[model samples]
Target: MLYIQLTPFPELHTERFVLRRLQQADAPALLDQRSDPRIMRYLDREPDTTLEQTTALIERITQNAADNSGVTWGIVRPAATQELLGTIGLWRIMAEHHRAEVGYGLHPDYWQQGVMSEALAAVLDFGFQTLKLHSVEANVNPHNTASRRLLEKHGFVQEAYFRQNYFFRGQFLDSIIYSLLTPEAAKPELINEAATEL
Candidate 1:
Protein backbone atom coordinates (compact mmCIF):
# COMPACT_ATOMS: atom_id res chain seq x y z
CA MET A 1 0.00 0.00 0.00
CA LEU A 2 2.92 2.32 0.79
CA TYR A 3 1.00 5.08 2.49
CA ILE A 4 2.99 8.27 2.88
CA GLN A 5 2.62 10.85 5.59
CA LEU A 6 0.36 13.72 4.58
CA THR A 7 0.96 15.75 7.72
CA PRO A 8 2.78 14.91 10.92
CA PHE A 9 -0.43 15.75 12.74
CA PRO A 10 -3.54 17.46 11.53
CA GLU A 11 -6.15 19.42 13.42
CA LEU A 12 -9.45 18.58 11.76
CA HIS A 13 -12.39 20.94 11.75
CA THR A 14 -16.11 20.63 11.20
CA GLU A 15 -18.90 23.19 11.32
CA ARG A 16 -19.28 22.87 15.09
CA PHE A 17 -16.12 21.28 16.46
CA VAL A 18 -12.37 21.03 16.29
CA LEU A 19 -10.55 17.72 16.41
CA ARG A 20 -7.02 18.43 17.58
CA ARG A 21 -4.25 16.44 19.16
CA LEU A 22 -4.56 15.83 22.87
CA GLN A 23 -2.39 17.69 25.37
CA GLN A 24 -1.52 17.36 29.06
CA ALA A 25 -3.99 20.08 30.01
CA ASP A 26 -6.75 17.89 28.61
CA ALA A 27 -6.03 15.19 31.20
CA PRO A 28 -8.83 16.24 33.51
CA ALA A 29 -11.40 16.10 30.75
CA LEU A 30 -9.90 12.90 29.40
CA LEU A 31 -10.18 11.41 32.86
CA ASP A 32 -13.83 12.34 32.99
CA GLN A 33 -14.49 10.97 29.53
CA ARG A 34 -12.63 7.71 30.15
CA SER A 35 -14.05 7.01 33.58
CA ASP A 36 -17.70 7.11 32.66
CA PRO A 37 -19.17 3.62 32.66
CA ARG A 38 -21.58 4.61 29.92
CA ILE A 39 -18.67 5.64 27.71
CA MET A 40 -16.43 2.72 28.65
CA ARG A 41 -19.10 0.03 28.54
CA TYR A 42 -18.19 -1.26 25.12
CA LEU A 43 -14.51 -0.36 25.09
CA ASP A 44 -11.96 -3.09 25.62
CA ARG A 45 -10.08 -1.18 28.33
CA GLU A 46 -11.11 -0.56 31.89
CA PRO A 47 -12.57 2.77 32.95
CA ASP A 48 -9.65 5.05 33.81
CA THR A 49 -9.65 5.16 37.60
CA THR A 50 -7.16 7.95 38.26
CA LEU A 51 -5.76 11.20 36.97
CA GLU A 52 -2.41 9.50 36.69
CA GLN A 53 -3.90 6.88 34.42
CA THR A 54 -5.30 9.59 32.18
CA THR A 55 -1.94 11.34 32.12
CA ALA A 56 -0.28 8.09 31.14
CA LEU A 57 -2.85 7.62 28.39
CA ILE A 58 -2.14 11.10 27.06
CA GLU A 59 1.57 10.31 26.95
CA ARG A 60 0.99 7.06 25.09
CA ILE A 61 -1.29 8.67 22.50
CA THR A 62 1.20 11.48 21.98
CA GLN A 63 4.00 8.99 21.46
CA ASN A 64 1.94 6.96 19.03
CA ALA A 65 1.19 10.05 16.95
CA ALA A 66 4.87 10.86 16.85
CA ASP A 67 5.66 7.30 15.82
CA ASN A 68 2.98 7.44 13.09
CA SER A 69 1.27 4.43 14.64
CA GLY A 70 -1.89 6.26 15.79
CA VAL A 71 -3.42 9.62 16.69
CA THR A 72 -6.22 10.80 18.99
CA TRP A 73 -7.99 14.14 18.99
CA GLY A 74 -9.81 16.04 21.67
CA ILE A 75 -13.24 17.06 20.48
CA VAL A 76 -13.50 20.74 21.31
CA ARG A 77 -16.19 23.28 20.65
CA PRO A 78 -14.38 26.60 20.66
CA ALA A 79 -16.95 29.30 21.03
CA ALA A 80 -17.33 31.36 24.21
CA THR A 81 -14.91 28.87 25.78
CA GLN A 82 -12.83 25.96 24.53
CA GLU A 83 -14.95 23.13 25.86
CA LEU A 84 -13.99 19.55 25.24
CA LEU A 85 -16.94 17.31 24.42
CA GLY A 86 -15.25 14.00 23.75
CA THR A 87 -12.41 12.20 21.97
CA ILE A 88 -11.93 10.38 18.67
CA GLY A 89 -8.95 8.66 17.05
CA LEU A 90 -7.49 6.46 14.39
CA TRP A 91 -5.35 3.79 15.99
CA ARG A 92 -3.29 0.82 14.86
CA ILE A 93 -2.50 2.66 11.66
CA MET A 94 -1.18 0.10 9.25
CA ALA A 95 0.57 1.93 6.48
CA GLU A 96 1.48 -1.26 4.73
CA HIS A 97 -2.19 -2.19 4.67
CA HIS A 98 -3.58 1.32 4.27
CA ARG A 99 -5.99 0.83 7.11
CA ALA A 100 -6.58 1.83 10.74
CA GLU A 101 -9.05 1.33 13.55
CA VAL A 102 -11.42 4.13 14.52
CA GLY A 103 -12.32 4.68 18.16
CA TYR A 104 -14.31 7.39 19.92
CA GLY A 105 -16.21 8.32 23.08
CA LEU A 106 -18.39 11.25 24.10
CA HIS A 107 -19.53 12.65 27.40
CA PRO A 108 -23.04 11.57 28.34
CA ASP A 109 -24.04 15.22 28.49
CA TYR A 110 -23.44 15.50 24.76
CA TRP A 111 -24.83 12.17 23.71
CA GLN A 112 -27.75 12.19 21.20
CA GLN A 113 -26.73 15.67 20.08
CA GLY A 114 -25.09 14.52 16.85
CA VAL A 115 -21.71 15.58 18.26
CA MET A 116 -19.88 12.28 17.84
CA SER A 117 -21.44 11.75 14.49
CA GLU A 118 -20.14 15.08 13.26
CA ALA A 119 -16.70 14.69 14.80
CA LEU A 120 -16.28 11.18 13.39
CA ALA A 121 -17.10 12.39 9.90
CA ALA A 122 -14.22 14.83 10.12
CA VAL A 123 -11.87 12.17 11.46
CA LEU A 124 -12.81 9.80 8.68
CA ASP A 125 -12.19 12.60 6.20
CA PHE A 126 -8.69 12.99 7.60
CA GLY A 127 -8.10 9.27 7.54
CA PHE A 128 -9.11 8.84 3.95
CA GLN A 129 -8.21 12.19 2.39
CA THR A 130 -5.19 13.19 4.42
CA LEU A 131 -3.68 9.87 5.39
CA LYS A 132 -4.78 8.22 2.11
CA LEU A 133 -6.02 5.19 3.94
CA HIS A 134 -7.85 2.60 1.88
CA SER A 135 -10.21 1.60 4.68
CA VAL A 136 -11.08 2.29 8.28
CA GLU A 137 -12.24 -0.32 10.81
CA ALA A 138 -14.23 -0.32 14.01
CA ASN A 139 -14.75 -3.02 16.64
CA VAL A 140 -18.02 -2.60 18.43
CA ASN A 141 -19.65 -4.65 21.11
CA PRO A 142 -22.82 -6.03 19.56
CA HIS A 143 -24.82 -4.85 22.53
CA ASN A 144 -23.96 -1.19 21.96
CA THR A 145 -26.82 -0.42 19.62
CA ALA A 146 -26.26 3.32 19.53
CA SER A 147 -22.60 2.99 18.69
CA ARG A 148 -23.33 0.43 16.04
CA ARG A 149 -25.95 2.71 14.54
CA LEU A 150 -23.50 5.58 14.38
CA LEU A 151 -20.99 3.42 12.53
CA GLU A 152 -23.66 2.23 10.14
CA LYS A 153 -24.82 5.78 9.49
CA HIS A 154 -21.26 6.62 8.52
CA GLY A 155 -21.36 3.88 5.87
CA PHE A 156 -19.45 1.17 7.72
CA VAL A 157 -20.69 -2.31 6.93
CA GLN A 158 -20.66 -5.24 9.29
CA GLU A 159 -17.69 -7.26 8.16
CA ALA A 160 -17.49 -9.94 10.79
CA TYR A 161 -18.70 -11.07 14.17
CA PHE A 162 -16.51 -12.79 16.73
CA ARG A 163 -18.27 -14.35 19.68
CA GLN A 164 -16.47 -14.05 22.99
CA ASN A 165 -13.47 -12.90 21.06
CA TYR A 166 -12.21 -10.11 23.29
CA PHE A 167 -11.02 -10.88 26.80
CA PHE A 168 -11.32 -7.77 28.93
CA ARG A 169 -11.91 -6.90 32.55
CA GLY A 170 -12.04 -10.55 33.68
CA GLN A 171 -14.64 -11.46 31.05
CA PHE A 172 -14.78 -12.24 27.39
CA LEU A 173 -16.99 -10.17 25.10
CA ASP A 174 -18.42 -10.55 21.64
CA SER A 175 -17.23 -8.14 18.96
CA ILE A 176 -18.70 -7.06 15.67
CA ILE A 177 -16.26 -5.69 13.13
CA TYR A 178 -17.35 -2.93 10.79
CA SER A 179 -15.44 -1.36 7.97
CA LEU A 180 -15.75 1.63 5.61
CA LEU A 181 -13.84 1.75 2.42
CA THR A 182 -12.50 5.03 1.06
CA PRO A 183 -15.23 5.16 -1.56
CA GLU A 184 -17.89 4.87 1.11
CA ALA A 185 -16.18 7.49 3.25
CA ALA A 186 -16.62 10.05 0.51
CA LYS A 187 -20.41 10.08 0.87
CA PRO A 188 -20.48 11.98 4.13
CA GLU A 189 -19.67 15.26 2.48
CA LEU A 190 -22.43 14.83 -0.02
CA ILE A 191 -24.76 13.67 2.69
CA ASN A 192 -24.06 16.80 4.65
CA GLU A 193 -24.69 18.90 1.59
CA ALA A 194 -27.98 17.15 0.94
CA ALA A 195 -29.04 17.74 4.51
CA THR A 196 -28.25 21.42 4.13
CA GLU A 197 -30.56 21.68 1.12
CA LEU A 198 -33.56 20.46 3.08
Candidate 2:
Protein backbone atom coordinates (compact mmCIF):
# COMPACT_ATOMS: atom_id res chain seq x y z
CA MET A 1 0.00 0.00 0.00
CA LEU A 2 1.15 3.54 -0.63
CA TYR A 3 2.44 5.31 2.48
CA ILE A 4 -0.07 8.08 1.99
CA GLN A 5 -2.87 5.57 2.02
CA LEU A 6 -1.52 4.07 5.19
CA THR A 7 -1.16 7.30 7.17
CA PRO A 8 -1.57 10.36 5.06
CA PHE A 9 -3.26 12.58 7.60
CA PRO A 10 -4.07 10.77 10.76
CA GLU A 11 -4.15 12.41 14.16
CA LEU A 12 -0.96 11.86 16.16
CA HIS A 13 -1.20 11.17 19.87
CA THR A 14 1.69 10.51 22.21
CA GLU A 15 2.04 9.33 25.78
CA ARG A 16 1.52 12.75 27.28
CA PHE A 17 0.59 14.91 24.32
CA VAL A 18 -2.41 15.03 22.07
CA LEU A 19 -1.66 16.48 18.65
CA ARG A 20 -5.09 17.56 17.51
CA ARG A 21 -6.41 19.80 14.77
CA LEU A 22 -6.83 23.43 15.73
CA GLN A 23 -10.26 24.94 16.01
CA GLN A 24 -11.49 28.51 16.38
CA ALA A 25 -12.23 27.96 20.05
CA ASP A 26 -8.53 27.29 20.46
CA ALA A 27 -7.80 30.96 19.80
CA PRO A 28 -8.54 32.11 23.30
CA ALA A 29 -6.22 29.48 24.71
CA LEU A 30 -3.53 30.43 22.22
CA LEU A 31 -4.00 34.08 23.08
CA ASP A 32 -3.76 33.31 26.74
CA GLN A 33 -0.39 31.67 26.25
CA ARG A 34 1.07 33.70 23.38
CA SER A 35 -0.25 37.19 24.05
CA ASP A 36 2.40 37.56 26.67
CA PRO A 37 5.50 39.35 25.40
CA ARG A 38 7.68 36.72 27.00
CA ILE A 39 6.23 34.11 24.65
CA MET A 40 5.80 36.24 21.53
CA ARG A 41 8.95 38.34 21.68
CA TYR A 42 11.06 36.01 19.57
CA LEU A 43 8.10 35.06 17.40
CA ASP A 44 7.39 36.56 14.01
CA ARG A 45 4.31 38.41 15.15
CA GLU A 46 3.23 42.02 15.19
CA PRO A 47 3.88 42.13 18.95
CA ASP A 48 0.32 43.32 19.51
CA THR A 49 -2.16 40.50 19.03
CA THR A 50 -5.82 40.55 19.97
CA LEU A 51 -8.33 37.78 20.38
CA GLU A 52 -9.62 38.54 16.90
CA GLN A 53 -6.21 37.96 15.38
CA THR A 54 -5.84 34.71 17.23
CA THR A 55 -9.23 33.61 15.97
CA ALA A 56 -8.23 34.48 12.45
CA LEU A 57 -4.98 32.58 12.78
CA ILE A 58 -6.92 29.46 13.71
CA GLU A 59 -9.14 29.98 10.69
CA ARG A 60 -6.08 30.25 8.49
CA ILE A 61 -4.67 27.05 9.91
CA THR A 62 -7.95 25.29 9.22
CA GLN A 63 -7.87 26.56 5.65
CA ASN A 64 -4.43 25.09 5.17
CA ALA A 65 -5.69 21.79 6.48
CA ALA A 66 -8.56 21.92 4.02
CA ASP A 67 -6.19 22.62 1.11
CA ASN A 68 -3.93 19.79 2.29
CA SER A 69 -0.92 22.06 2.06
CA GLY A 70 -0.20 21.77 5.79
CA VAL A 71 -1.69 21.47 9.23
CA THR A 72 -1.05 22.77 12.72
CA TRP A 73 -1.46 20.51 15.72
CA GLY A 74 -2.25 22.06 19.04
CA ILE A 75 -0.27 20.28 21.74
CA VAL A 76 -2.28 19.64 24.84
CA ARG A 77 -1.74 17.52 27.89
CA PRO A 78 -4.42 14.86 27.97
CA ALA A 79 -4.17 14.71 31.72
CA ALA A 80 -6.39 17.77 31.93
CA THR A 81 -3.40 19.94 32.60
CA GLN A 82 -5.60 22.86 31.55
CA GLU A 83 -2.80 24.59 29.70
CA LEU A 84 -2.00 24.95 26.05
CA LEU A 85 1.57 23.72 26.16
CA GLY A 86 2.39 24.64 22.57
CA THR A 87 2.01 23.75 18.90
CA ILE A 88 3.70 21.53 16.33
CA GLY A 89 3.17 21.99 12.63
CA LEU A 90 4.21 20.66 9.27
CA TRP A 91 4.01 23.81 7.20
CA ARG A 92 5.29 24.70 3.74
CA ILE A 93 4.75 21.18 2.53
CA MET A 94 6.38 20.34 -0.79
CA ALA A 95 4.58 17.19 -1.78
CA GLU A 96 6.45 16.87 -5.04
CA HIS A 97 9.70 16.88 -3.14
CA HIS A 98 8.41 14.94 -0.14
CA ARG A 99 9.55 17.53 2.38
CA ALA A 100 8.19 20.08 4.81
CA GLU A 101 9.21 22.79 7.21
CA VAL A 102 8.61 22.14 10.88
CA GLY A 103 7.79 24.86 13.39
CA TYR A 104 7.06 24.82 17.11
CA GLY A 105 6.64 27.08 20.11
CA LEU A 106 5.62 26.59 23.71
CA HIS A 107 4.31 28.45 26.69
CA PRO A 108 7.31 29.64 28.66
CA ASP A 109 6.00 27.77 31.65
CA TYR A 110 6.45 24.49 29.77
CA TRP A 111 10.10 25.10 29.06
CA GLN A 112 12.73 22.75 30.53
CA GLN A 113 10.13 20.07 30.99
CA GLY A 114 11.19 17.98 27.97
CA VAL A 115 7.67 18.30 26.62
CA MET A 116 8.66 20.04 23.41
CA SER A 117 11.47 17.64 22.71
CA GLU A 118 9.23 14.68 23.35
CA ALA A 119 6.60 16.18 21.07
CA LEU A 120 9.21 16.90 18.41
CA ALA A 121 10.33 13.29 18.41
CA ALA A 122 6.77 12.24 17.72
CA VAL A 123 6.35 14.77 14.91
CA LEU A 124 9.64 13.85 13.30
CA ASP A 125 8.63 10.23 13.39
CA PHE A 126 5.33 11.18 11.85
CA GLY A 127 7.12 13.14 9.14
CA PHE A 128 9.38 10.33 8.08
CA GLN A 129 7.49 7.10 8.73
CA THR A 130 4.00 8.41 8.12
CA LEU A 131 4.17 11.37 5.71
CA LYS A 132 7.27 9.96 3.96
CA LEU A 133 8.99 13.34 4.01
CA HIS A 134 12.61 13.18 2.89
CA SER A 135 13.71 16.02 5.10
CA VAL A 136 12.46 18.47 7.69
CA GLU A 137 13.76 21.97 8.19
CA ALA A 138 13.23 24.41 11.01
CA ASN A 139 14.23 28.06 11.15
CA VAL A 140 14.76 29.97 14.33
CA ASN A 141 15.98 33.42 15.18
CA PRO A 142 19.68 33.20 15.93
CA HIS A 143 19.31 35.05 19.20
CA ASN A 144 16.81 32.49 20.48
CA THR A 145 19.28 30.18 22.16
CA ALA A 146 16.60 28.01 23.71
CA SER A 147 15.02 27.17 20.37
CA ARG A 148 18.41 26.62 18.79
CA ARG A 149 19.24 24.22 21.57
CA LEU A 150 16.03 22.28 21.10
CA LEU A 151 16.53 21.81 17.36
CA GLU A 152 20.11 20.79 17.82
CA LYS A 153 19.06 18.27 20.45
CA HIS A 154 16.77 16.60 17.96
CA GLY A 155 19.51 15.64 15.48
CA PHE A 156 18.99 18.77 13.39
CA VAL A 157 22.15 20.31 12.06
CA GLN A 158 22.70 23.99 11.59
CA GLU A 159 22.65 24.28 7.81
CA ALA A 160 22.95 28.05 7.41
CA TYR A 161 22.72 31.28 9.28
CA PHE A 162 21.05 33.94 7.21
CA ARG A 163 21.82 37.49 8.18
CA GLN A 164 18.93 39.92 8.48
CA ASN A 165 16.54 37.35 7.20
CA TYR A 166 13.52 38.29 9.28
CA PHE A 167 12.22 41.61 10.52
CA PHE A 168 10.96 41.10 14.02
CA ARG A 169 9.99 44.07 16.09
CA GLY A 170 11.99 47.05 14.72
CA GLN A 171 15.20 45.43 13.54
CA PHE A 172 16.37 42.81 11.13
CA LEU A 173 17.14 39.53 12.85
CA ASP A 174 19.43 36.72 11.86
CA SER A 175 17.82 33.34 11.27
CA ILE A 176 19.41 29.96 11.72
CA ILE A 177 18.47 27.12 9.42
CA TYR A 178 18.40 23.64 10.91
CA SER A 179 17.54 20.45 9.08
CA LEU A 180 17.34 16.73 9.71
CA LEU A 181 17.37 14.17 6.94
CA THR A 182 14.73 11.45 7.04
CA PRO A 183 17.24 8.85 8.19
CA GLU A 184 18.57 11.13 10.90
CA ALA A 185 15.17 12.25 12.02
CA ALA A 186 14.18 8.61 12.46
CA LYS A 187 16.71 8.05 15.19
CA PRO A 188 14.70 9.73 17.91
CA GLU A 189 15.43 7.12 20.53
CA LEU A 190 19.05 8.03 20.13
CA ILE A 191 18.23 11.72 19.96
CA ASN A 192 16.35 11.60 23.22
CA GLU A 193 19.16 9.81 24.98
CA ALA A 194 21.63 12.37 23.63
CA ALA A 195 19.43 15.24 24.68
CA THR A 196 19.90 14.07 28.25
CA GLU A 197 23.58 15.02 28.11
CA LEU A 198 22.98 18.47 26.70
Candidate 3:
Protein backbone atom coordinates (compact mmCIF):
# COMPACT_ATOMS: atom_id res chain seq x y z
CA MET A 1 0.00 0.00 0.00
CA LEU A 2 2.80 2.40 -0.92
CA TYR A 3 1.78 3.85 -4.25
CA ILE A 4 3.55 7.08 -3.35
CA GLN A 5 6.72 6.09 -5.15
CA LEU A 6 4.92 5.35 -8.39
CA THR A 7 2.93 8.54 -8.13
CA PRO A 8 5.43 10.77 -9.83
CA PHE A 9 5.30 14.35 -8.75
CA PRO A 10 3.25 16.02 -11.46
CA GLU A 11 2.59 19.68 -12.12
CA LEU A 12 -1.13 20.45 -12.13
CA HIS A 13 -2.91 23.57 -13.32
CA THR A 14 -6.32 25.08 -13.78
CA GLU A 15 -7.74 28.42 -14.91
CA ARG A 16 -6.38 30.42 -11.95
CA PHE A 17 -4.26 28.08 -9.85
CA VAL A 18 -1.07 26.09 -10.30
CA LEU A 19 0.02 23.08 -8.24
CA ARG A 20 3.76 22.72 -8.10
CA ARG A 21 6.69 21.93 -5.82
CA LEU A 22 6.87 23.88 -2.53
CA GLN A 23 10.14 25.79 -2.06
CA GLN A 24 11.64 27.29 1.10
CA ALA A 25 11.06 30.65 -0.46
CA ASP A 26 7.35 29.95 -0.05
CA ALA A 27 7.68 30.30 3.72
CA PRO A 28 6.83 33.98 3.72
CA ALA A 29 3.68 33.53 1.68
CA LEU A 30 2.67 30.51 3.71
CA LEU A 31 3.31 32.43 6.89
CA ASP A 32 0.73 34.93 5.73
CA GLN A 33 -1.81 32.13 5.66
CA ARG A 34 -0.55 30.41 8.76
CA SER A 35 -0.56 33.62 10.75
CA ASP A 36 -4.30 33.63 10.86
CA PRO A 37 -5.83 32.20 14.03
CA ARG A 38 -8.44 30.32 12.08
CA ILE A 39 -5.85 28.54 9.97
CA MET A 40 -3.34 27.90 12.74
CA ARG A 41 -5.69 26.60 15.44
CA TYR A 42 -6.18 23.23 13.80
CA LEU A 43 -2.62 23.26 12.49
CA ASP A 44 0.51 22.59 14.53
CA ARG A 45 1.81 26.16 14.41
CA GLU A 46 0.85 29.16 16.45
CA PRO A 47 0.04 32.53 14.97
CA ASP A 48 3.13 34.32 16.29
CA THR A 49 5.66 31.92 14.79
CA THR A 50 9.14 32.87 13.59
CA LEU A 51 10.65 32.85 10.13
CA GLU A 52 12.98 30.02 11.09
CA GLN A 53 9.97 27.91 11.94
CA THR A 54 8.53 28.55 8.53
CA THR A 55 11.87 27.59 7.06
CA ALA A 56 11.80 24.34 9.04
CA LEU A 57 8.30 23.70 7.78
CA ILE A 58 9.29 24.32 4.20
CA GLU A 59 12.21 21.98 4.72
CA ARG A 60 9.84 19.28 5.90
CA ILE A 61 7.76 19.83 2.80
CA THR A 62 10.92 19.64 0.73
CA GLN A 63 11.78 16.42 2.53
CA ASN A 64 8.44 15.01 1.58
CA ALA A 65 9.19 15.85 -2.03
CA ALA A 66 12.66 14.32 -1.80
CA ASP A 67 11.68 11.27 0.26
CA ASN A 68 8.79 10.64 -2.06
CA SER A 69 6.60 9.75 0.92
CA GLY A 70 4.03 12.17 -0.42
CA VAL A 71 3.85 15.06 -2.81
CA THR A 72 3.28 18.63 -1.61
CA TRP A 73 1.91 21.08 -4.14
CA GLY A 74 2.07 24.76 -3.47
CA ILE A 75 -1.19 26.35 -4.56
CA VAL A 76 -0.37 29.56 -6.37
CA ARG A 77 -2.38 32.24 -8.08
CA PRO A 78 -0.59 32.71 -11.40
CA ALA A 79 -1.98 36.08 -12.45
CA ALA A 80 -0.78 39.65 -11.83
CA THR A 81 0.39 38.44 -8.46
CA GLN A 82 2.01 35.02 -8.43
CA GLU A 83 1.52 34.55 -4.72
CA LEU A 84 1.50 31.29 -2.82
CA LEU A 85 -2.00 31.28 -1.50
CA GLY A 86 -2.27 27.84 -0.03
CA THR A 87 -1.25 24.19 -0.12
CA ILE A 88 -2.83 20.95 -1.34
CA GLY A 89 -1.10 17.64 -0.93
CA LEU A 90 -1.43 13.87 -0.84
CA TRP A 91 0.11 12.16 2.16
CA ARG A 92 0.27 8.74 3.84
CA ILE A 93 0.33 7.11 0.43
CA MET A 94 -0.65 3.45 0.59
CA ALA A 95 0.34 2.56 -2.94
CA GLU A 96 -0.23 -1.17 -2.61
CA HIS A 97 -3.76 -0.30 -1.61
CA HIS A 98 -3.91 2.60 -4.05
CA ARG A 99 -5.21 5.06 -1.51
CA ALA A 100 -3.94 8.20 0.19
CA GLU A 101 -5.01 11.00 2.49
CA VAL A 102 -5.52 14.41 0.96
CA GLY A 103 -5.15 17.66 2.87
CA TYR A 104 -5.44 21.35 1.99
CA GLY A 105 -5.41 24.84 3.48
CA LEU A 106 -5.86 28.30 2.05
CA HIS A 107 -5.36 31.87 3.16
CA PRO A 108 -8.39 33.33 4.85
CA ASP A 109 -8.46 36.05 2.23
CA TYR A 110 -8.99 33.38 -0.40
CA TRP A 111 -11.51 31.36 1.57
CA GLN A 112 -14.99 30.89 0.13
CA GLN A 113 -13.63 31.77 -3.29
CA GLY A 114 -13.69 28.21 -4.70
CA VAL A 115 -9.91 28.20 -4.78
CA MET A 116 -9.47 25.09 -2.65
CA SER A 117 -12.09 23.15 -4.53
CA GLU A 118 -10.52 23.95 -7.87
CA ALA A 119 -7.09 22.97 -6.62
CA LEU A 120 -8.46 19.73 -5.18
CA ALA A 121 -10.21 18.85 -8.39
CA ALA A 122 -6.91 19.09 -10.22
CA VAL A 123 -5.10 16.94 -7.66
CA LEU A 124 -7.82 14.29 -7.39
CA ASP A 125 -7.58 13.78 -11.10
CA PHE A 126 -3.83 13.39 -10.92
CA GLY A 127 -4.32 10.91 -8.09
CA PHE A 128 -6.94 8.64 -9.61
CA GLN A 129 -6.24 8.71 -13.33
CA THR A 130 -2.57 9.53 -13.74
CA LEU A 131 -1.33 7.82 -10.57
CA LYS A 132 -3.99 5.12 -10.68
CA LEU A 133 -5.13 5.62 -7.12
CA HIS A 134 -8.39 4.04 -6.04
CA SER A 135 -9.48 6.20 -3.14
CA VAL A 136 -8.81 9.37 -1.16
CA GLU A 137 -9.76 10.28 2.37
CA ALA A 138 -9.86 13.42 4.49
CA ASN A 139 -10.23 14.31 8.17
CA VAL A 140 -11.76 17.57 9.21
CA ASN A 141 -12.94 19.29 12.32
CA PRO A 142 -16.70 19.01 12.40
CA HIS A 143 -16.99 22.69 13.11
CA ASN A 144 -15.17 23.54 9.93
CA THR A 145 -18.39 23.89 7.98
CA ALA A 146 -16.66 25.29 4.94
CA SER A 147 -14.22 22.42 4.65
CA ARG A 148 -16.88 19.80 5.37
CA ARG A 149 -19.00 21.28 2.65
CA LEU A 150 -16.08 21.31 0.26
CA LEU A 151 -15.51 17.59 0.84
CA GLU A 152 -19.17 16.85 0.36
CA LYS A 153 -19.17 18.98 -2.75
CA HIS A 154 -16.33 16.83 -4.04
CA GLY A 155 -18.31 13.66 -3.23
CA PHE A 156 -16.61 12.58 -0.03
CA VAL A 157 -19.08 10.98 2.35
CA GLN A 158 -19.23 11.44 6.08
CA GLU A 159 -17.96 7.98 6.92
CA ALA A 160 -17.10 8.63 10.54
CA TYR A 161 -17.50 11.33 13.18
CA PHE A 162 -15.33 10.89 16.21
CA ARG A 163 -15.71 13.04 19.31
CA GLN A 164 -12.81 14.66 21.18
CA ASN A 165 -10.25 13.43 18.73
CA TYR A 166 -7.74 16.25 19.17
CA PHE A 167 -7.19 18.98 21.71
CA PHE A 168 -6.71 22.43 20.22
CA ARG A 169 -6.96 26.00 21.42
CA GLY A 170 -6.85 24.67 24.99
CA GLN A 171 -9.84 22.39 24.52
CA PHE A 172 -10.72 19.09 22.88
CA LEU A 173 -12.39 19.12 19.50
CA ASP A 174 -14.37 16.55 17.54
CA SER A 175 -13.34 15.25 14.15
CA ILE A 176 -15.26 14.06 11.13
CA ILE A 177 -13.76 11.61 8.67
CA TYR A 178 -14.70 11.54 5.03
CA SER A 179 -13.85 9.10 2.28
CA LEU A 180 -14.47 8.72 -1.44
CA LEU A 181 -13.67 5.63 -3.45
CA THR A 182 -13.14 5.35 -7.18
CA PRO A 183 -16.63 3.97 -7.66
CA GLU A 184 -18.02 6.81 -5.60
CA ALA A 185 -15.98 9.30 -7.53
CA ALA A 186 -17.09 7.97 -10.91
CA LYS A 187 -20.70 8.75 -10.08
CA PRO A 188 -20.01 12.48 -9.67
CA GLU A 189 -18.72 14.44 -12.61
CA LEU A 190 -17.03 16.95 -10.30
CA ILE A 191 -15.07 14.15 -8.68
CA ASN A 192 -14.13 12.69 -12.01
CA GLU A 193 -13.85 15.85 -14.09
CA ALA A 194 -10.07 16.20 -13.87
CA ALA A 195 -9.80 12.43 -13.49
CA THR A 196 -9.42 12.09 -17.22
CA GLU A 197 -5.98 13.39 -18.11
CA LEU A 198 -5.61 15.77 -21.00
RMSD of each: 6.8, 6.9, 6.0
Q: After superposition, how far is residue 156 of candidate 3 from its true place, in Å?
A: 0.3
Across 14-129, the per-residue lDDT of candidate 2 in tens digits comes to 88888877767677788877677787777777643699888888888877777777777888888754456788898677787787899887888888998888889998998888
Model 3 TM-score relative to the real fold: 0.83
Q: How many residue pairs clash in all the candidates, one count each?
A: 0, 0, 7
Ranking by lDDT: 1, 2, 3
TM-score of each: 0.88, 0.83, 0.83
lDDT assessment of candidate 1: 0.87
Candidate 3 residues lying further than 4 Å off, grouped into runs, are 6-8, 41-48, 184-198
Once fitted onto the true fold, the runs of candidate 2 whose alpha carbons sit more than 4 angstroms away are 1-9, 184-198
Residue 77, candidate 3: Cα error in Å is 2.6
- Candidate 1 backbone collisions, by pair: none
The worst-scoring run of ten residues by lDDT in candidate 3 lies at: 1-10
TM-score of 2: 0.83
**Rank by TM-score (best first):** 1, 2, 3
Q: What is candidate 3's CA lDDT for residue 13?
A: 87
lDDT of each: 0.87, 0.79, 0.79
